[model samples]
Target chain A: MSDQKEERGLRELYDQDPERADYLAFGRKTETDRRGFLKGAGLTAMMLAVGGAIPFARNMPSGLIPSALADTPEDFTLFGKTGIIIRNDRPVNLETPAPLLDPDVTPIENFFVRNNGGVPEATADPEAWTLTIDGEVDNPLQLTLAQLQSDFETVTLRMQLECGGNGRAGFNPSPRGNQWAIGAVGNGEWTGCRLRDVLQQAGLKSSAVYTGHYGADPHLSGEPGRPSISRGVPIDKALEPHTLLVWGMNGEPLPLIHGGPLRVVAAGWPGSCSQKWLTRIWVRDQEHDGPGMTGLSYRMPRNPVPPGAEVPHEDMVVMGPMPVKSVITFPDTLTDVRADEAFEVRGHAWAGEHEVQAMHVSYDFGATWVEAELEPPTNRYDWQRWRARITLPAAGYYEIWARATDDTGVMQPAVVPGWNPRGYGNNSQHRIALNAA
Target chain B: MRGRKLRTGLACACLGLMMAGGASGQTSDFGGLPAGPGQLETFGNCTACHSTMIITQQNFSRRTWDEVLTWMVEDQGMWEMPSETRQIVLDYLVTHFGPES
Candidate 1:
């Protein structure tokens, strides 16, 4: 509460005194904020170094440079995570490169990290971690990892997890936040109990209509009470057998970077629905209105708003299942395929809340199309691998395109589907450049 | 106590920041915005919450820039700037980081 008051005061400084407002915003006390910050030790040193060009002389965070200016550091791929495109470093938001995501089951090292806030400190012992279930329940229960394991029936399923803004980079005029390509996704076999089973143990009251999630991540602003991002599903979606409280990923203890100690994995939904480092589940009688749930945060315009329209809160709806999408993974964008006589191409296709009924590949930019043989998903909600063979007509500067059609008849668009304020639900067909000699 | 304030001003912003020490260039930390009118005010106001990368990377028109500013206050928790300050910052952004620039 005091932090909220302090922040409001800091914001008011801009109107209070425009001249010294910026300096005063950071000062601990309002009384001494203006002149004291102007004559501080760091400013004194900075003034000396810049030879009294005092107005623009305050350096960033004492020798902090923009990550773009710095070369890619060797140490970014920590905890065996590798070959990822790091869009921002402060909160550690990184995405996998398309090539590295080719594996049948995405390896942990190649998985993307989409952190909205600070990565919570790695638990010294994960087993000691506990989870709290409250709100609209007959009995609120606090359970440790051991109890969660022994108390509930566990199930393992291979599921596809994709960010809501997976292909945001393709949006023209650009959308805000992480400019992810088609790599902010992964499929892994997660081991956990159904959220339904656990919530029943808490004895949900009939009024439990929605759920709000909370996690260990603190806000990027370093505010202790603030949550980085919290979102949840409706009562019906929450009750799905696939909605799991996952503790393990791909046969290993969930790595800390991947939200190890505990997380909620609601497959086929936007990755945000699967809260990482989950600590609390607040079952609500109404829809959850937490950070990521309200307004345009992870929502699509209910009625398509023009590119730059100032959409009202009511026009936006919380993101639901991901759209049908496919990506070419194999034959790895080989620069030179010797005058191809039917070279094989393969990739993964997934339909959110549906199945990929068909996948088509084009070597000549949609002028011609050929069907790829789609394999059955190892389990429902898992990605299906598809393969096809194509022969280029007198190869020279060709590209490979892949698109998927969902069971419900939605086809991947060759171009971006619709422009929302945040550049979400971009299920554009993915293509890779290749030179055929 | 005042020293701590300056550090807080420099050390953190609204969006997350990394303390990559030994950075030699002050302007680089300010996202390498070239010196111009409103440069100081813009840096002071914006660097508090976000790295200039957010600004430097955009390719919006002057109109879009204005809309983004309005949206920042309405949706993204940015305080409404004083009228003069807002005009100055807008002018600086368009001049230095507009689509044509």
Candidate 2:
């Protein structure tokens, strides 16, 4: 059958019954190909032709879906075109489907996207983009991207950057901000100069206490004077070996959506601290009160609070390294497994600045736990891969849970952590249900 | 070989969408929100900067919605909504995606 005829046939099928089109397109009933062949060789050819047009077929449903559905950018790497839950679009906020995550470093494409404000109108010229270091520094320096490469030593390390409110959806009241589930966190290899090296070149003053970060994304309201977000980290955290002024992600130039021509990879802290489209690093003599630092933006109560209790800003402490956490990246929740088969459960675990000392898996909802094989981290801030195998005794349904302990002796809580108004740092045990039938 | 894999992937996606049984695109219209008195107005205003999915996904109470609106205006630089329109949207949101309890 001619390809054009095949294409026409497929298009006609789509135009008629979208449901049937979906069924055929997905090849769910491939066993009935003989029946389709009976219709004609054209139909069979069209099925084969659909493979070559996968990219096109993936988008064909857009025309059929209601126009109220927003259009995703064609070029940006998406975890899954249909799997991700987009929370916003101006400063794009996309959540990752937990299942799409890679057990190792998250590829730039699968990495969850979180933007504070609208994307910059102008694309940065890597050669011309400059970063300025000023404020309490003895010698303010303005260095272009080219100079940043030539003047400093470059290093690469695998690190995890997680939004403070990553699992905020678990909050009982369901916090007011972006309600991410598990995909708001990712581990990636970052290539850049150490933030300390850049600060050293500028000669930090003894009084320097914090480093304010400035990025190029504009405010959502289109205000020129106010940036969308301009947060900072403590000077000590800025000087940590893993804190980087990175231009590369997963061995490629940082994607603009994930912050590029320049951004800070402030490892072990809330992703907000790692400013994107970073243009300037201003050393401050006092704690910097930039865009997201005030009140309870990223702060949590120093002591646990009642799930619904409110705490004033003074009683809240600035968010630091995240608590110990683990997420199952394999066998996704609710997957069907063969009864009596020993299946491997795999996941990734990380603890803020501390190492993931151990991981425990429970098959009977938390009644009993067994140690999972924990793989050592590849780098200082990298997540540790872990796995455990279990054979179902009988076929029914089962819930698998994973909990990790940090070097600091902090273990994942069985229930959601102390809830704040914003619902930050919810390092609760991760669980997935599967049917054995 | 890659072409075959791509075809299989597309086929799987189609089956998955069929099983889910709704809009087949990456995003949904109005995020499956039910049409209401202020649906259009809410969509027009809230979606100016984001998808309607953002509004539909939240389960905040009326009080929390008010606070969120305040934060968006004061900190996130969202323009202040006129009181009447604001009331309409708030009522619509509270009624539709209000506190889960």
Candidate 3:
């Protein structure tokens, strides 16, 4: 498709001034700066086309205009073009309902999207934005995108970025959290300045224990009014060798919705702490208290609750990396046997920070366990991919479940604990039904 | 505010027209029985972060709705509201969205 036509089409469609549609859609292709305009417009359209295709493919039910201008009560809720559908935030038992894609990469187009507030509209220029680092630093610095790119020794790392609520649907009596599907994750090569390098340049003092990062997006109606989703990283994690102030993702500039211009890649930290649209960082002697930090939401129960109960105050634990779990992405059928004699069973497994020590597969729903080959961990913090093959024990219906244990000995629960108010931490054994011929 | 009023009027007019086309045949899952079509209004409030499919797909009793609201407030981190506002939200759900008993 002609990039110019696509850009003109989008501009005409979304342009606030309805009359601008004619100008954008059919205006005389002006001779002035036409080449540069087409070039830039082409790039923007390419980005939007890829980004927009995602919602239609999997994010939600198609065609949801952002809440910024949704006219009616119904329009406010539904994105008109995308197939993504939202549910009333309530607690219920959620099962991971879809097949996974590749074991290593969760494609951006397929990654599940879960935001406390609605996804913000894309910005025109993230590079023009600035990052302000202050608080307990020898030098409080304000740096721009170009400056960040050129100032420090840059680094790249392959990491998995997952929302804290990535597996909320796996819980029973699902808690009220961002009702995300399996798509709330992505594997990307994040490139940027190491946060530790930046901190060393600023010269962190001994008293600095916690660091806070802020983003540029305004707190809007859809999110929690007070606690915007920002969090603190311990000085050590902040200064970890691979911790990054990322600008590029998957070999390109970061997309606006994914925290363009700048965002933190705190590999393995809950998606909560990798602040998007990051604009500021503070080194504090004590813990910080932003809404994303000690907010009433996002806290996990100190202990598991029954099927229908609340977490007592003393039992509240902060939410973190998803529990170790796996899923079957192929042959998501109950009984239709495949004629292909070789039935390959494969899926993805991830641990928050610990290495996936082992993955056990059960053809008979935990009655017997078999060893599955493991893909090396993505990073110390990211999840890893795993695969295995099984010979059909005669053409028959079969149930498959996979579980993983981290180095810390955390095993997937066969049955999830009771639901809490905020749905968090749903690391249950994932089961799928299939038939072999 | 004027824009909202005008939009509201226009929406009500559209809904009235949809209803006049024999409300009997339209909107299948919801009962034709009287309790009022508060579905649109309830949807407007619930979808800030959530999708309406959450409610449409659910089969729950009023007690479950009450339990859900409590869970929304306590677990999902929704801001607590006055007892009266809570009652209005609950009544709306129970009246328009009671489970099939």
- Among the candidates, what TM-score does chain A have in each? 0.82, 0.82, 0.74
Cα lDDT tens digits, model 2, A125-166, are 787899999999989999998898889999999999999889
Ranking by DockQ: 2, 1, 3
Interface Cα RMSD of candidate 1? 15.5
**Candidate order (lDDT):** 2, 1, 3
Interface RMSD of each: 15.5, 11.1, 16.4
Superposition error at A239 for model 2 (Å): 0.5
Off by over 4 Å in 1: A1-79, B1-28, B31-43, B61-83, B94-98
Candidate 2 error regions (>4 Å): A1-83, A122-124, B1-33
Q: Order of candidates by TM-score, top first?
A: 2, 1, 3
Comparing 1 and 2 on TM-score, the stronger one: 2
Model 2 vs truth, CA RMSD: 10.4
Candidate 3, A43-92: lDDT as tens digits: 23322322321211111211112222234332111111122222221211
Q: What is the DockQ (computed on Cα atoms) for candidate 3?
A: 0.08
lDDT tens digits, residues A1-437, model 1?
12122111211222233223233222212223222333454455434322233443332332222232122233222334555554544455667777777787999888987878767877888877999999999999899888898899999999999999898877776676777778889998899999999899899999999999999987755557788798999878888999999999999999888898899999899999999999999999998999889977999889987786778879899888999998888776656786757788889999989999999999888888899999989888899999998887785888899999999889999988889988888999999877777
Better of 2 and 3 by TM-score: 2
Output the worst ten-in-a-row residue range by lDDT, candidate 3 chain A. A75-84
Number of the top DockQ candidate = 2
